[model samples]
Target: MSSPRGGTARTAPPGRNPAPQPAPPPGPNPEPDSTGLVPYPAEVAARYRAAGLWRGHSLPAELMAAARAHGDRTALITPEVRWSYAELSATAERFAAGLLARTRLRPGDAVMFQMGNVAETVVTYLGCLLAGIRPVCTLPQHGTREVAVLARHLGARGLVLQADFGRGQLPEQARALLAEGVIEEAVVVRGEVFGKAVGYGELLRAGTGNDPGTLPYHSRPPEGVAVFQLSGGTTGLPKIAPRQHEEYAYNGALWGRTLGWGEGTVVLYPLPIMHNAGVSLALQPALLSGAALVLAPSADIGTLLDLIERTRPQVLPLVPPALAIRLLEEPRSHRTDLSCLTDFIVGGQKLPLEVAERLRDELGIAVRQKFGMAEGMFLLTPSGAGEWIRHHTVGTPLSPLDEIRILRPGTEDEVPDGEIGELCVRGPYTIRGYYRAERHNASAFTLDGFYRTGDLARRHRLGGAPCYSIDGRIKDVINRGVEKIHADEVEDLVMRHPDVAHVALVAMPDPVLGERACAYLVMEPGRAPLTVATLGAFLLGEGLARYKLPERVESVDALPLSNVGKVSKKELRQDIETKLAAETV
Candidate 1:
């Protein structure tokens, strides 16, 4: 078959390895470019390539190869569409060609995505890869403030938005951004185009007559930046992490293989498809392994149950703790024929043992725990793990090359086994630094190159294998299901209110969401106490995402402080926990 770049595509004979390519000459790490992308150190890159961990193939080429191998197999399924491997590949190429033909966008340009879980999202994402455009995987819930911050940081060239999202306000927002020159172009999906915006369908039609084989696809090396993943915003604004084609692909392939996904495997994902987890865990893995991916438009329990009944997916890859709780609580879940499901992976927050046990006992399905970040380290409970390990621990690293260290918080000293400490890691897939964050990178990574995950964990030996259990987080961020709310970001926004003297956002224990932000405030002298509704309204007006708004508000005389003069969040957390326990009683 011809390559997307108008050349014959190379493939090895079946049952044989591909011929090795020559490596680049030894040298120092390349300087950061205008895009703020830092290349892996020369020796490190060579080591990964030599170990075959960093395969020298672009993402688009890998997708095309999968199509060639599984042409007739169903690859994508949504409420309104069902695309086979061949059709998905052809349509993606058409979209890629159309993007170049109909718009100013070109290969290597960065485009921000603000779409939902739908077939068009997959098509547009894959098309961007094929056209050599880098997608900034921003969530639909992101408001103008967040989007503007990310767009400005990455110098994003365009945006792909779901017009119907956010009560049809997304289109207006996109148009405003275009008018303001914040972004060069906007592509609307599932909505009418207006004022310098193009319809997605129109773009696809524009390339119908063009031959994809003759189009100039992305020519960058496999290690080149393929997409931008957003950090969980431990500090404040979400930082961008540039994911390369090789490591990102390796991430998905490794997870898919670890879970034993095959062509017949139907994987159902109900989360936001544009998020990093969605792409790495669901989209790439399923497509690369020739597995069928079922896209549930929403995470509503009823919707999820109905999709499971129809799709009969063997894997529900990235379920949050809240969704798992809702599924078990929903009456329809009992009636749904979930026997086809073999693996139900849970992550994004600590899964209560009760929830994991109930899912396993009531559903008779293997419940696997996962711990991952957009920065690239992934840990998952093996499929064959025992109930204790699966219920209590997040399991081992996905790659054998992954190097992990447990260090004392705020120091580089190693922590003994079974002792709680900060998790630090370096691996073939883990990123060395975030995009354009030079100052933050110094503290985010160790001098030796390990990325310091702000999570507290402890080493464990479960089922005769080394495992890790998440104890807590050292970062001041609240994990509310799949979305993380930066405490400082919210506190800063709340402090904007004239009546607020001081505010502290802390995670309150939640049975459903695992945790919800509760705002404790010391109001300005003589000011009326803030209500949850009033505070939420204030925050929403301040351009914070609805998910980040605090669910509860409390009046405090003063916030506890540590000996270092910092807000004693630990004491506040304990106070709130005690209150919640008393209320439950």
Candidate 2:
């Protein structure tokens, strides 16, 4: 299970010395009041700094250093553009200066990013960091409704978007938001810009004669929030997780070193660049390690295989289970020369053992399993793990300092090693609490500070180290490939339909996506039954992301209830599973 470069799956590479932990910096820790962010306690922050886990440098600083070290080397590649390290750094600085000069945004302002996997996405994100502006990483698939909710929640002043993406409705949405004063500025990329919206090229050109060094690039401390990553929450629209500069950088560096990435390493990333995995697992790591990052605009299997054949990348860091299935189904995948690939990490959902075996036996690819969250803990299958440990388990924590606890579902009691329980974690990289979410934080984090990750997992001994395997989830969220569909959110929306009386959304088995949302509806007695297409169109019109719509609809007389009269989702899940099995038979 060694990496193609022969590096073992240890925390650090073989000969590299662990970074020396330093004492706490000589200053009072910044209070979280200003930004509504929840900062780590003073003692805990001190401990992390002492343990060398929380380095004292901003993300922009790291990129600047990389630029100096790997100046002329290619940093990013897209279908339409290629940028060198020096070029990226310069353009980012220019964009940052332009943002300050042209827009109403200040150093500490928040900007919403809803762009695709293009070169501008990278440049814009880096620019925000360089200017000490926090970027809210929203998906391009999001519409006006989703963006409005998130933007209003964060009090974001600016929106950076791709104008031509997906039916080209973003410009109209941006215009509407601007008219309503929901956002003050809109920076449109790659399309016709109308109204008060400023073109991205215009913004970039605005900084032409300005000196980047004169700007307040280092105004904010490294301990301040650098980005806001969205959580897949069950109760509502996603919660915001504020990532600090120091800890977030460490997350990327640790992952890059773990996978043996270096100057010559080229990693292909086709996932949403604004997602947590895209930033931590691919972008940050590649930049910090001075490796080349190839961005794929589409996740189509044929497109990906073609990219691999042309780029000959050494790593494909974040492939979801659905994409893996599609690759295996594509004839070109088997014919392509994937010999240059050394690591193929599958995550977002559990990789079935059968699929894992097929990948290894037929394609000669050793698949590594990853389990991570926006809140911060990461687990990956070790390179030296046994077959059972590699395929069945999701491996151990990425950091030696990561503390894990398996607690009973409703209580703080620890479960036995082999039994499944809720996964609770508290570490340097993991946040103490989500931003401005005090009500939810009360139950999300324990009094002692562990974040209750709503995932159910079990621990096992592998090679004398404790490895973990995910069994199920305690949250009412369905993992549809990389997109998490919260049942409660969809149920609330469905209840708004005129003919719907009662509705329950549950996860149904899917061969490719792993899980798809199935809606069990008890429609109004005299009304005609609703179809999946009608319900999907209704939900889409309601501004919900297309991915969150129910794929299958069923009309039930009534929803099964537990003893306490609560809707029994467990029973609904069992019912759907039984019906699906019968249909297959």
lDDT values, one for every candidate:
0.80, 0.81
User: Tens digit of lDDT per residue, candidate 1, span 1-585?
Assistant: 221111111222233222323332323334467767777787877877786777898777777778789999999999999999999988888898889999999888899998988788899998888888999998787777778788888889899998987598898778778877889989987777877788889889987878777655546679888899988642355578899888888888877877778779999988887878888899998998989999988887888888888888989888876577667767778877888988888888667666676787887767899998989989888767788888888987776566677888877777777888788877678887889887778788776677789988888754354788887677777989989886856776887787976677899989889899999998867999999999999989999999999998989987765321235778899999999999989
lDDT of 1 at 328: 76
Highest TM-score, which number?
2
lDDT of candidate 2 over 96-140, digit per residue (tens): 888888888888888998898899999999988888888999877
Q: Could you tell me every candidate's TM-score relative to the true structure?
A: 0.78, 0.79
The TM-score obtained by model 2 is 0.79
> What is candidate 1's TM-score against the reference?
0.78
Clashes of 1: 0
Which residue pairs show backbone clashes in model 2?
none
* Residue 102 lDDT in candidate 2: 85
Superposition error at 183 for model 1 (Å)? 0.7
Q: Residue 578 deviation, candidate 2, in Å? A: 19
